[model samples]
Target: MSAQLTAPQTPAAAPAAEPAGRRPRRGTFGLASKALVNGLLAISAVYTLAPLAWLLIASSKNRKDLFSTSPYSVGEFHLLRNLSDLFGYDDGIYLRWLGNTVLYTVGGAFLTTVISVACGYAFDKYVFKGKEKLFGLVLVGILVPSTVLSLPLYLLASRTGLVNTYWAVLIPSLVNPFGVYLARVFSAGYVPGEVLEAARMDGCGEVRTFARVSLPMLAPGFVTIFLFSFTAAWNNFYSSLMMLNDQNLYPVNLGLYAWSQNTHQQPELYSLVIVGSLVAVVPLIVAFLCLQRFWRSGLTSGAVK
Candidate 1:
């Protein structure tokens, strides 16, 4: 009886109830924050896409529909008509301009990539006199805007009778300080000393090792340099305008500028110019999409190491 009474004195444990409304409050707050963030992101995405949307819509309109119809409206689809007109204009001069642009971009970019890769690799790998000073000079070149040098380049080209020629544009593009800097960074990260030493042990010459082993590893860097140089050359207006007086030698940028000026008098040319602008951007988009993997991989390769 005493044992039973002692046992009965133990207080009953408190009932374990669900947390009073705290969970619901927290859940509501989280949901509200997420909704706000999503809303903002949606708005930002729309804003970013708006210009491309307008360009796509505008390119589909003819001369009359461009001004009269709604800017965003899907008018009588005239994209094919516009393309035909663009190609047919001035005995297919637009096509010629397109070719010239491709040549300038691809040619200059290729040469620039080669030069940058060689210079950067040499600077990083070879021990030479005044290396720091030379690299410092290159950094100075990077700090100096290309526009500032345009006049000097023009004078030099004029003296050498290289002005008013494709070489005027191409040769200048071949010397990209930024590309060289990027190449140096890439070489330091990707081109390992151990691999180089192993290649040397295997009786590989420097040239052979670079061509076979190092160049393949530097593909990502090369692609990036190529794209940069290509875009720079393609969009180069001032240099091309200053260097090229002949309409036949004009790249798309200069050609478009010429068209833009005439658009004041020939209102119909306005539609063509818009359509041409839209067309011009396509190559750049294609190039980026195609080489995006290399660009991304190149950037992230050294993040861990």
Candidate 2:
């Protein structure tokens, strides 16, 4: 009896083979499920890409071809000519609008990133009265829709005589509460209290420590916030419409919208609007490609340590 107990009781009879037919059926079911998922994704991708495909084809056509030709078919290969006409129209106002968009997006995103980083760093590294309350207020602002702020912002801009000016747009973009929130998160993850304490022990002043020690670690987060702010300010339309009346100050998005409205009056503007849209997309694509690395690095930086 003792020897049999010590021998592992014949290995427990190997618990029956889970029915060989059931194994094949389970594998088939899994494959069918995978195929179904792949099919759904393909359909969704086609739906999303269909309009974009048409835009590319339509931008290459003249007005006559745009209305007449199949969406995917080529028509006279007028992309270069359409671009020329787009730029030459209204004394090259499209180029002017493009410049304006760059100004707004770049300037606003930069300032917003700086402000956010500073605010977040302070929140994470320092303890002060009402810190949580102030952060809670920032979170609340995030829940408030941007559109709701437009009317109030417009009213304020009108009162200050900033309406129809760059300040009207730039001022609002600088007050990004969401950036502040992200900055705090990044600070908590990327910058350690121990590191900050060491900097303090080294006789470094607060600003000097943050500038030299904390900032480099926070670079990825800054890029992420800047991308968000840039996209928001670049695509901004409702606020710009509410604040600006002058065509000269209109960003590329609003300029495109204006051109769209006039398409019925001048059929050629239809092609210009389509081509101009494609042009507007180029900078964003380039920015995304260049900055995507920073974003990916940021997502994983705080996870490990």
Candidate 3:
């Protein structure tokens, strides 16, 4: 017996470990995607803001500098002079236009928001016959071009003797089918049935429940609707043109349009129009800045819930 010639068995070699530095990088793909998205957004932003930048600069330049100088170049700072001229032109009629715009936008937007939100809340929370049918009609109304209704609206206003009156503009502004649709969506998301039921169970009436309980929760929706309606009313050119013949009753946009139309005959009015447009843009900017948070939240209401 040759002392049990059992050879020692060697251990199997271990698999080679991959290098840490050579690991596949996920950050590369992520960074590239982010860069692409950011580039597109930056381009879009420049496209959108360029006109506004032009407007701001042009608003500051005197008439000679407006056309003679480069568009993006700084000219004589005539913003104050231009504003003075704008206010003094035509016996300060620009103020009248601004006042009219404020009146129409604030009054009409408030009423429209109220009506639309109420209708939407009812549509969302209440049970009734023909509810879906009525909402479908609203959707149909949204599809109809606003311009198409202009003739009929004019005729109706004529029949009722509302033509060339504030009512003609304000009345039409109050009927916002899109606002109603948005309100219904917001109501569905922001409001819960249980809270409404609890309010009712506490002997709260329908109107009271809405006013005290639900309306508070619907603040974001209301502000959103109001902003939309306000912008529409502020920029309401065609309607104001058809509805108002009195220069004093014209909103800022329509008044500026009138000035622009007369620019061929009165070259100085070009400056006035430019300056007035800048003034007209201020309120809208302020409103958006103030309500931006609520507006953003309102927009995302139904997106999550």
Candidate 4:
């Protein structure tokens, strides 16, 4: 009788131990799923980074090594030599082009952001006659391609004796309809009515309230608009090409295009052009990396509601 009771208790204990063993299998399956997801992300990251890595490596090599050496391997590192040769190749024209790009980007971006923000804020806060009609017009403007308008704009600039000048490029770039639309969206989300009401009740003037209260709230939107305008101006090729006849006024994009055209005739310039392209991309990367935190926060703040 004692042996029978002991045997029954052992069978019950075995069933309990079996569940404990099965728990590890379930944990392992979960870990495997996580591992698979992580691996895929790693692969995607590598694919995205590969081109940038190649650009860096290629830029380090000179003309001879660039063509002959392995694309992945670092060949006799001559980045400084390449940069010096790049700057001195044509009476330091590259430096001038860089300066022109900076000026265009900074000037165009500043004016565009200010104008867009003002337009957007007014559209959001003010209730005036023809508001919807005007906004509809703005939407139509957004749909109109910049390329199509380029010819008309060029003609107008020529008539005004502004063609081939910086103003011609700067003025058109400042009137970005898309930027205005983005600004309106950002203003609607960021600038709360309560805050504006509070400011007004405190005896603040409209302009004063906007500068102190609204502008601070719209900083992230301003940064976003600035970056968009800056990138567009920096990369603008057709407008710059059409507007300017002088080499001194050329931005880096047009300058690079000129070099690329000559590459077929003077193949040595091929390496220089490649190297220059690699160098040209660095500022954009740096700007994005620096401003990404603010951008992320701003986007998320608007999205959370």
Each prediction's RMSD over C-alphas, in Å, is 6.5, 5.1, 7.2, 7.3
Question: What is the Å distance of residue 187 in model 3 from its true position?
Answer: 1.0
Per-candidate TM vs. native? 0.85, 0.88, 0.89, 0.84
lDDT of 1 by residue, 1-305 (tens): 35544445778899887787765345887899999999999999999889889999999998888989888998899999999999999999999999999989988899989999999999999999999899999999999988898899999999999988889988888899998999999899888887788888889899998897788878888898889988888888888888899999999878989999998898888988988999999999999999989875643343222
Model 1 score (lDDT): 0.88
Candidate 1: which pairs clash? none
Per-candidate clashes, comma-separated:
0, 0, 0, 0
**Candidate 2 lDDT tens digits, 189-278:** 888787778888889899998888888788889999999999998899999999999999999999999989987887777888899999
- The better-scoring model by TM-score among 3 and 4 is 3
Segments of candidate 3 deviating more than 4 angstroms: 1-23, 296-305
For candidate 2, give the lDDT of residue 250: 97
Q: Which stretches of candidate 1 lie over 4 Å from their true place?
A: 1-44, 298-305
Candidate 3 lDDT score at position 215: 80
Off by over 4 Å in 4: 1-40, 296-305
The number of clashing residue pairs in model 3 is: 0
Flag the better candidate by lDDT, 1 or 3.
Answer: 3
Best of the candidates, TM-score: 3
